[model samples]
Target: MTLPSLLKRALADLWNDLGTHMLTTVVIFLSALIFSFFSLIYFNLQNFVEHFGTELGLVIYLNKATPQDRIPALYQKLAGLEGVQAVVYISPDAAFKRLASYLKDEKDVLKGVDPKFLPPSFELRINRAVFHLDRLKRLAEKINRWPEVTKVQYGQEWLNKLKRFSVLLRAVVLISGLLLVLSSAFVVSNTIKLTVYAREQEMEILRLVGATNGFIQGPFLIEAFFQGLLGSGLALAFLYAGYRYVETLMGASCLLKGVNISFLPWTFIGIILFGSIFLCVSGTALAMRRFLRL
Candidate 1:
């Protein structure tokens, strides 16, 4: 049969089997839901990593009496250090100003507090790749050993625990997403198998009249493809709507800010769409293998 004629028959078969096709749609929706949840977590973890690389809280506070000219040499030295990305000098006056602005509404409470209370500090940012806690703390210790340096800090145990927690959660999310994808494929295949079984007699009649296996199988293949594409389209729509809802609710939080939390990426969408179609085709192919002997 010509491609057009075969496609027409496939559409008719799909319409006749809409009851069975709905199960595949359900599977797609479930898979999409799972993808959205995992994607959000992964994106947030990546954002936190970026903040550590640039806006890190590693502060090297200098002694209050450290001279102005000495600051430049320290900044230059720190910037050229092994793993440093950049070193920003914050004079005591600037630090005091920031402290005052941050507590702008508390001016009455700051009446007797001198700006000298705030230390002259240098903020350190480093390359993300070299940011292991042991190396960073060791670097900080080396700097503090100098008589000019008062202290060095980078969240110590807090950073350590956050890194570990993020790693663990990422692993769990990856495993969960993989399991959901596999389950959806299995469900789609089973649904396709049922449809093939239901239409076995029609397939047999075509074969009896000298139809080739290709002719007998062409319509089923097309129907399976249509079902998969339709289901995938539905899943994408639902996933996008959910993203909008979450963004609205979490707009005040940086967790979703600057992170593209929309529908899954096109690459992922393609994977899901093609994956469903492949599952259906394989399911139909294997089911017909048994009964094609007739």
Candidate 2:
């Protein structure tokens, strides 16, 4: 048959089972929507984890009796240290002010302590490219031995735990995504199987007439492609509406706290749509393989 005739036959067959095709499409769309939702959450969590990790650094406290004239020299030394990005000095008054802000709910407690009791400190940010736990620990120990230095503190244990949790989150996302894809593919394949089974007689006839398996499967694949496209489109629309409703409810609260709540990026949306199309095509091919065994 000519190319036009082949396409005409494929279109006719696909049109004959509109109801079943549509049902399959809806199932595929829902699956894609769920996957995209999970991905959106994963990306946000990943962003938070990275930000927290990058902000992790050491705080160096100077002795309370340390002279003010020596601070600039100490600051210069710290700034010149290898792996140190910058050192910001915090005066006793500033420290006390921050303490008050942190304990604002219990203002009466601050009345008991003198602001002079607060020591000066330096916030040390390290070069991210050279950050190493062992190296940081050794540097902290060395700094602690300085005559003017009271202590060097970094949340080493907490940072280790945070890093581990980030790894665990990635693993969980990967496993969950794989399971979702497999389950979605299974459901789509079963749905396509029904259509293939219904056309068994036609497929057999085409096979007997020397038509290749590709020719016989062309219409089914075409139908699946359209089903994937339409399903993903519908899914995206619903996701957008749901996201808007959620934003209206929570966006203000997040912004008030200087936090940002965001939805999935357009790139990811594209991935979901293309992934849905791929899944449907794969499912249809798998279904055809079994039925076209003759």
Candidate 3:
């Protein structure tokens, strides 16, 4: 049969059974929505982790009595260290100014502060490739032993917690994603089976008239394709609306002041659409196979 003929027949079938098709579409939509929601969470978490990684570094505070002349040598030594990408020296005045900027809203708190009381420091940007906890700990320990250094701070506890949380999040996403796929396919397959059963008599008539399996299944597959496309598209639209609403609601909240929430990327959007269509078609094919014994 021609593609146009198949589409026409599919449309006719859909119009004749609008109620059933609507229900099936709703099922697909809900399934896609749930899956997409979790995927969005994982995507954001991954982005946050990467951003944190890029910003991760060490701050080496100098002793108050450390010689001012030793700073240049200390900067070069840190720059030459393995896994150190760059070393920036922060003078006492610069550090003091930064602290003041942070506390600008509470200016009275710094009224009696002196820049001389603030220690100078070196901020070391570490190479991402070697940004492991153990490696960072080793580096911090070695730097802490320096006579000119007062302390080395790298937020080791926070990084360790983040690493553990990231691993757990990945595992949960993987397991739940598999479960969602299987459950969605099962539900869709069963729904499509009912659709096939409803038209069993017509299929029998076609078979008796010597119709090929492909010819008999073409319209049904096309119908499934339309359902999948409509359902997935609507699901994405609804999800985006909800995402935007939440984002707007949180935009002014102090808790999320510096955080950025983004929508799914084009690659993920394409995957969800393609996966929805594939699932629907595969489900219909499975139902047709069982009914036709083909």
Candidate 4:
């Protein structure tokens, strides 16, 4: 048979067993949707963390009596340090002013407090190229030895926790995605196997009439491809609706601020679709292998 004839036969067979085809497609759709959903979350979280990492750094507080003349020198030295991106100098007066603004409504509370209570400091941002835990620890120790410095504090515990959490999230996404794909493939394979069994006599007749294995198998593969394509399209549509619903539910209070929690990008969407088709085709191919001897 020609290519067009084979495709027509495939469509007819798929439609003839509409209930089973629909069931298999639904299973594939749900699996693909879940995989894409978690994948998007994982990528979005990675992006958020990378951007948030800029806020992770050391705050070097200088002594209260540190002279103004020496402040510029210390700032220059800190800025020139390896792995340091930029050093922001906050004078005691400026710190005090910021505190006053925070308690602006309670002006009486600041009546006796002196600006000297707030010490000058340099906010040190690390360069992304060398933003490692060991580097940060060594830099903090070096800064603590500065004669003009009073103390150094970096959010080591929280940064480590965030890194660990990101790793855990990725592992969870990977394992869950694998399980979903396997489960869906099992269902699709069994469904296709049943369909093949139902038409066993017809396939046997074709084989006896000089039909090559590929010729007999072509329609089944084509049918599986259509099932996968339809399933992926449905999954994407459902995901889009879910995305909109979530966006609406989040309202204006999403703590992510500038981050977009929308659907995955086009490239990821293509991957998800292609992965679904590949899984379905593979399941069909496996099922056909044992029956091809007929």
Please give the range of 10 consecutive residues that has the lowest summed lDDT in model 3: 45-54
lDDT of 2 by residue, 1-294 (tens): 456776777678768877888788878777777777776667766665444444767899999999999999999999999989988999998999998999889867989688877899999998877776667778889899999998898887776676677677777777877887898788888888888888888788988998888788777777777888889888888877887877677756755344445778889888888888888888889888976777
Per-prediction tally of clashes: 0, 0, 0, 0
Give the range where candidate 1 is weakest over 10 consecutive residues by summed lDDT: 256-265
After the best TM-score superposition of candidate 3, give how far the Cα of residue 264 lies from its true spot, in angstroms.
Answer: 1.3
Off by over 4 Å in 3: 63-65, 80-86, 93-118, 125-150, 252-257
Comparing 1 with 4 on lDDT, the higher-scoring candidate is 4
Give the per-residue lDDT digits (tens) of candidate 1, residues 11-107: 8877877788787767766775676567656656655654553356478999988887888888888888888887788877788778788888885
lDDT of 2 at 182: 90
Model 3 pairs in collision: none
TM-score of candidate 1 against the unseen true structure:
0.79
Off by over 4 Å in 4: 81-85, 125-147, 248-251, 254-259, 265-267
Residue lDDT tens for model 3, 1-294: 888988888999999999888877888898888888887887887777656754868999999888889888998889999999989899999988888898888857877778778999999998887766678889999999999998999877777787778778877877876887788888888888888999999999999888988889999999899889988899999999999988997788999867788899999899889988999998899889865764
Who is ahead in lDDT, 1 or 3?
3
**Candidate 4 accuracy as TM-score:** 0.84
Full candidate order by lDDT, most accurate first: 3, 4, 2, 1
Model 4 over residues 121-227: C-alpha lDDT tens digits? 99999887667766787889988998888889888777677778878989988999989988988888899888878888888888899998988899989988888
Q: What is the TM-score of each candidate against the true structure?
A: 0.79, 0.74, 0.82, 0.84
Q: When superposed on Cα atoms, how far off is each prediction in RMSD?
A: 3.8, 4.3, 3.5, 3.0
